[model samples]
Target: MPQTIQGFSRLNKEEKIDWLTSNFLSDSQNATSILKQYWNSDAKLQQLHDEFIENTVTNYYLPLGIAPNFVINNKTFAIPMTIEESSVVAAASKAAKFWMSRGGFKAEILGTQKIGQVHFTYTGDAQKLSSFFELTKSILLNDLKTLTASMEKRGGGITSIELINKNDQLANYFQLHVTFETLDAMGANFINSCLEQLAESWQREYNNYPVFSENNAEMVVIMSILSNYVPQCVVRAEVCCAVSELTEADGIDPEVFATKFVQAVRIAEVEPYRAVTHNKGIMNGIDAVVLATGNDFRAVEAGAHAYAARNGSYSSLTHATIENGIFRFWIEIPLALGTVGGLTKLHPLVKLNLEILGNPSAPQLMEIIAVAGLAQNFGALKSLTTTGIQKGHMKMHLMNMLNQLDATDTEKSKAIHFFKSNKVTHSAVDSFIKNLRQN
Candidate 1:
């Protein structure tokens, strides 16, 4: 039975913690001590972290790791990844190293157009709204000039704005569909600002239209916001090599591997059940990189999934093909990333990750992230088609299992050695450790 407190956000960190612990926890002092223990040693830096979001709380940390040896466009890079999941960084690193000798990855930006919308309900004739939109479009642009000035100087601004009718889907529904080029920034704030301005200007200017008086139908503005479905803001990353060069050190035939890889991608393309898991593996890599670089992974995930199902069925984001004795594996994904705004400039690790990446522009970051996804998918597919996925994955997960079981260092080392040749299952490890303690 926690009670609400007014001005909770205005409270200091210790006061906020005191309120939370007193209301929610059985031991207020212990909980407060626990929260303070996670605070940064530097008071100024800790204050910065405290102000990053709403009410201040102790920081929740994830491993900030680098997957080394990513060779893209003939330049080598050690990509940074921030995630809690085991084996993701390892898998990506392995894939990068594997493709490095085969001329590495090649990436290209396909497009860089972000989207936003102004939704409204117009009870009047659709044709009239369209005509009114055409007439008032310039005014919308003029109203956005102050907002778009800085973005325009950086070579990014509103690309297009169109009035779209959705009467069949939702009665009296319409949208001011807008597109933009945000350049090196994700531009959600910028895009939403412009859309809100357009909405405000349109509502004011519509009163003067002849149709407004004739029809007596008002245009009621609903909301103005940026869309996460940025299909046009896409990039492609691929690795191509001779089928003979695609062989593993384990003596697996190159042609056999290529055939299985291509078939695996085809199955994902045709089967929705498999496609979800398949695309998730790809996101394992994409999300890690996106998170590391301080971009919106949720937005990237939503847009990528939407693009995957663009053809009426959810399919694989990564594709593999064999043509003219060459094996090609690639992925094309829409990523609205920013290198200069949001957490990119705020979060300490994000700044380091970007610096580690040689400070790529938005398009360049898109290429890197897309390559990471493609590399990740390749690692997963290669494992699935050969050694089986759980073999390596469970091996990587053994330490976590050991920690959960509260094994001592000696026990953990022994378990690691034992599981190296034995199966890694909860029961098996539990039995092994129990027997070891008994002995």
Candidate 2:
């Protein structure tokens, strides 16, 4: 029998951590040990540690919110997200619930392969160098093969190779695109290592001296580098949901609502002004999960935005439509993420999170991420479609106001009620609190 997942809203912070440990971490003692490595007993130290964890170490506790009622590929999954924005979780949960009312989200993943690039540059004859590399392609490939023999044994190896001319104001440079089939791993480290070895061999073969710079390197006034951009793999997901679930207590057709929602996203995708806010919504969920799992959120953000504009047209990362009285959603992005090595091994909480995800392989992880991106996009669209996005958000913002006011439970309740009933104001909250006290 499978274990039950506890609802996040019901548990406090500490309880949530404990539950995560119980469900994900195989050994409580190990989890505690890992926690102790970073956490201190002193209050001030603990606070500093928390900041460090958020800023430097694994920032898993950003904002562990919930997206409930997700039925993907006919299986129910309650997504626990760590995002700072207010509307994303609520909107995703609402979308999931709406979909469940219909038949739930249906999704499928294409494959689990990422592209890595090997760029070559020199002042020498470009045509000659290309001819040299081509003549020695078999030998160079054999070298790469030897370097990645272990990976090849694991059913992964360099699948394709290409060369491109990147022209610029300074000079034209040659770029070598090395495509690899990385199975169950991010393959960054592996790809870089193999490329560096190949570069050394290329340097020996050609007198131009092939230099492998992770970043742009200064080579006697000319610079050449290898990067992580080769469009080798693609991941796709689709969701179809019903409209009635989107209806409030009052009767409203969610399919019509979804049309309006798509219009809002279209505005965001086209207009530069709305595009900023639109991308912000997508990042709200992406950064949170990236932070939670000890991954580099900044890189992911950069890559996502760059990909959004990859087609030379500013566009939304998602597409939504209404078909057969149901709302359909789709998303495609070049998400080059890793599951093994790097911080995934360094951070204990990330390990715990991955374990809770049931040790998903790289393909499975990519599939989950693709789904998350779609779910997040759906959520933003839903919010922009109805309720104006601020009403629900401001209600949650009341928590901060309550904290600032230092109001008790009853006082907070009264203040919120009074604020909502009337025009919200500081004076109004104070007046309501005073009235409550008098009563």
Candidate 3:
């Protein structure tokens, strides 16, 4: 039975682990050993990792892979991907190689505006609030001088602020909508800090203005935060080639492949169930690169999914078409990523990953991430149209299954040889191992 304890956080790392294992785990010694096993060898580095979050226990790890021969904008790159899934890097690499011979990928940034808001409530005159906001907009900006000065010096700062009235949607609710140009940084902290300052100034300014005293109501500040759904921070990436070029050794006709591919994409666009899985494959590539580069994958994911449903229906983020003998595939996603801030500055692998990509700016990073998604989507759709998803995915998953079964070196070698000509599945591998051991 678990019991409450005071100041569990104040305990040392060892004490914390001891308490956790003693209270919760049946095998406390092994649990503690496992936790310590993942700790960094370098004490300083381990301390750095520990400081990343509160109640520090240990590190969690994922494999970092290199998907080579990605040619975007006529520039070749080997993107770094950090993920645990089987076949993601392989699929991405295959698609990248296929597109490399064609025109490669062309990408462009559509926009770079990020949004934050201050939610407040007031039963006062709506007209009076609007007029006051118009007059006090400069005051709000003036109050953020200290906050925006550094960002402005780098050619990015607050762009606009507007008063949004939402009384009909929710009683006495209003918003101070603000947009920003964050340049290279993801700017979550910067945006949030500026919003807090703006909120404080707004309350102070509203209280000082005696014109609001007639209403006998207070302007209540609800919350100030940056939004993860950044529709404006979007990028587009595409690949195009002659329909004949799509033909391969698999004997699938280029015209048939193109038709099937476009149909697959169309199904995803209309069917929410298919669209969800289709987009998951796209994010397999995007999230790998995003995580390897130390950006917020969760934020990018939320924004992308929200953008897919922006038209009142959840649809595919990727589009496809075959026009006049030209087959084209593309993806457009809202990815509010950063190359400079957050974990980029601290994690060693993130630094190297950024350098490997030639140190892209935030917009440039957005472009590369978008291209990864497109490449991954192409790989998945091509497999779905031609051989089938399982043929390659299960083959790639064979090693992981073998590892899980703890097959010996000789058993693993035999299993590899056998599965080369046979289909792979959990029961098949288990039976193969059992026969090998018995014989």
- Residues forming the 10-long window of minimal summed lDDT in candidate 3: 246-255
After superposing candidate 2 on the true structure, give the runs of residues whose Cα lies further than 4 Å from its correct spot. 1-38, 41-61, 168-170, 208-230, 241-251, 323-326, 416-439
lDDT of 3 by residue, 168-202 (tens): 99999999999999999999999999999999999
Evaluated with lDDT, which candidate comes out highest?
Answer: 3
lDDT score at residue 41, model 3, on the 0-100 scale: 96
Which regions of candidate 1 fall more than 4 Å away from where they truly are?
26-30
Better of 1 and 2 by lDDT: 1
Candidate 2, 56: how far from true, in Å?
A: 7.3
lDDT of 3: 0.94
What TM-score, to 2 decimals, does candidate 1 have?
0.97
List clashing residue pairs in candidate 1.
Answer: none
Candidate 3 clashing pairs? none
- Maximum-TM-score candidate: 3
lDDT (CA) for every model shown?
A: 0.91, 0.64, 0.94
List, residue by residue over 260-312, the lDDT tens digit for candidate 2: 87677667668767776777776776666666555666766766777777778
